[model samples]
Target: MLNSLLRISQKTALTLVFGLFSGLASAQATTYYFSNSGNDSNKGTSISAPKKSLAAATALAKAGNKLLFKRGDAWYIPFGLFDLSNKSGTRNNPVIIDAYGAGDKPVISNLNVLSDDGWENIIGTTTWKHAIYGYSKALRLFANGVSKYKVNTSDKLANETDVDQPHEWFIKEGVINKNGIVYMNTGSSLVAPKNVEVLMVGSKPVVLMENTNYFTFRNIDFRGGSTSNIVNIWAPSANITFDSCIIQQGAGSGIQAGHSGQGDLTTYVANINILNCLVDKVWSDYENDPNILLSGDGIFMLHAVEGGLVQGNKILNWGHSGISITSYILGVHGVHNLIVEMNDVSGGESAYTHAIDMNGFEGLTTHNIIRRNYFHDYTVTGHILGSYNQIYSNIFAGVTVTKMPRHSHQGWGVDWAVWRYRGTGPWIEAHHNYLVNNTFVSTEECAIMIQDSKANPIAVSNNVIANNIIYNFGDIAIDVNTNVAGTVIVQHNNFWQENSTEPVARFKNLGTKDVYNAAELNLVLPQYFRGNTQFNPRFTDVAKRNFTLTESSPTALKYGGTTQYTSLLGEDFVDYFGKKWDPFKPSMGAIQYNGGD
Candidate 1:
């Protein structure tokens, strides 16, 4: 009798435990579908009976639930707003928004259209403004889905000091009245609204993520907006991801991750990953570039964010820079421990822009890694690095067809590399950075140019540059503009020929002597120059486009342990020879003699 009672109790306890587990698992997860034909009145539990509006379906979402929009559908949210409030998802099970029933990707855009009645006839073609869109952020002017030209003006103008430059439209309140005006200079002396259709973005984002965490968006085509980027993250959210999506037609910018306040690094935005997405046309015709800062950027991440990765995105045709890893910390600020890799950023060759610009003007942005990216046709600075930044294993190429008219002698053709700044730092004036093992196939200028910009700039010491290949530089291999009084460690690199008759290094700025002048160029001279070899790396075949060094190449041979730049990035990592190579005999450049990536 006792044994029977004990066995019955044990079976009951096990059954209760399994029931609790099952209930928790079921409650924590669900799959919700959405279609235009469906009604919001349904429970949206199955694909057959789905919800109609994304906003209504989003309201019912919980953590770990999946919300899939019907493919081949378009949902124009009112006021371009898809607001999220007070929701959180863990890294293990994030709230997902993706597409279903594969065909064309589902699209979410703004529904508000600009009426021709709001635009009035203007007398002088200098400026045109219409306040149809909420008069904040930036705006764009488009005709038949193609970007049109704006009038160029050089006056004290409205808010931006970077005035006199070209803009498609300029929006300002009280310009004509309190309603705000949209300035349009279509290049004609007396401009009138033509037969072209026009669309304007109001002051709201198409997708706004606010005070939320761990939301994943995938396989969606986000389009249109007269105000700002398609998506905007306004809080210190974590694990926010966007993958396999198309972000197009941004008025101000493509995407902005975080904002700066109080210069506090503690309340940072973290763990944001933007991967495998297509971000295009982040161009603004009109912007409040007040003081000449803040314009259209494809992807802009700011503030001190730890643990982030930006990889495998094709960002193109931005009005300003493509990737702006920048901050606006009122006082000293920071951003560290991030990986930006495997991206193709191109076609952003505006006269006043660069491919990637990490603006550390507010504070120190350190320990960021940029590698394995392809940059083409960016006429200005290809890449600019601040202190504690690493630039390695990338290709910067400029094609002949896309080459602008800016490559004349004494112009900005050579672009720049490892361009340093000095507000304050630990390593001399500007230090703690590394440029290693990259390939530059430039057609206009030298391989690398170090510019301080101002007259008699201060020290740039304790930085390391090693094992890189620079080809097709027009004039000189290395050109230092302002005098750099600090130490810069340059080691075993290859500077190949472009114009054939060009010299190797052009120091001492002006009429330039052949010698490396320390005092004149404000450099410490040979003390900063360490074991950098200027020779042909001798690739297998230049015509066949085989860039790997041949066995007969001098750079293919052994480099000793004493020549290793182990102190640079705090790692004894592998380069051309891979990680398993004998440490004492490391080869030069990014491409190993064995031709491995």
Candidate 2:
């Protein structure tokens, strides 16, 4: 909180006090508690007379209010919450809804799990179909808290089954049915798993922030939505946050931070902070459309949601990408000036999907920071697409995807691309972008890939990739395909290898111009060579993941005592180990050196 305060300007502080804390200064704060055992008619002032429903607590909630749900209590389908709007508290005393007196985190689910597995077997086949209360739109089925691929009626699941054959599902009429027999092998038969749950689509979110502001939700477990987000931030509000909450298992995206109302981008959502939240297991119900884009995701920051901090979130498996910060607009008012840091984005379930994808389809998405993240095991950890963004101080461990069979191209540890909006040229110039001081270890294809989308012809220029450390094993370390006419800066990066290999090679797909890392200068001087060196940045240990360099490393002052990198990588920053940074005397890669710092 103090760090945040220190970053705010004097004018911004006054606006926060007046706009966010107006309610706190005018009225005394109140505390309300809710529990499963309490009644709706209770005063809800004390724990004994706490309110029963979330509706009652929200109805009475106001600024400077603390709404605490009893731990181990749950608010199920029949009593789902209404949207919270029009009410807000000040920054000093924001309205907080949190868990109290815990057995477990308070659960707020929109669907009931089907515990009774009274499945009727088919006449001849080994298939089974169970009756369910069906609803309109797509239906999502989950077993063991994971999304089951909805099977098509025409696809055969019999001879095409594998060793660990997937349990594909298809809905028939108002029932859930499985295709083919449950035979895993010639002799053994597979039984239907008991932990089956279905969710309906098209409903209000479990916790809807419709035109709401200045509120904080803490330590609450939100799950089980029906084609709706566990939490949705609707249009035209700010100072809203979700902190330290368990946000998971929704039929749709975990958190939807936008509202496509009337197409006004100037009056967009801003100052939103999603801090230290656990967003996991969110599945988009695409039974209706499997080819749907921008659906299942951990956190979808859409429609011009800008200027916020998305920090310390552990996101896992919500397909289209773990975290997608985008806007689907064309003209102006782009989503920019955001900080996405300290998040652990891992494990992609969908093909050709990345851990994070920030596309500026809406407007010129620029000036955002993607730093200090630990990405691993994902099909593509991040930035299959982005522009004018700063990506630095992040670790890429066990990066996957030797080649993108989907895109008919090879994948890399870091990718940057920009697409024009509706074929309109110059959406956002991919200029002034930076990828610096990052570490990529044990990568399959390459370390960094910088490309200019065909639609974005020449705007993808003036980007910088510097001071990086790569343990790239295959192909090239930096493969830049400048299909357009501008140049990208590459310099001062250290490449480590076990065996003899040309790690200093710079392969490019530039039409007529050739670019290479100058050996004498030790920088990738586009179109010519100045200088380069095979500088071994003697590390303490590499096998145990200790990337701290030895005191007598030669790569110190590798940039030649130049502070030019301060603009690209951001100054006064800490390294991977959270040690303080000295911009002038900087070390390469994510972590700062005690001696090197």
Over the full model, what C-alpha lDDT does candidate 1 score relative to the true structure? 0.58
lDDT of 2: 0.63
lDDT of 1 by residue, 177-230 (tens): 224555554445455444232334354677777567877899998876544576
- Candidate 1 at 382: error in angstroms? 3.4
Local accuracy by lDDT, each model: 0.58, 0.63
**All candidates: CA RMSD (Å):** 12.2, 6.0
Estimate TM-scores for all models.
Answer: 0.72, 0.81
Model 2, residue 260: distance off in Å is 1.4
Candidate of highest TM-score:
2
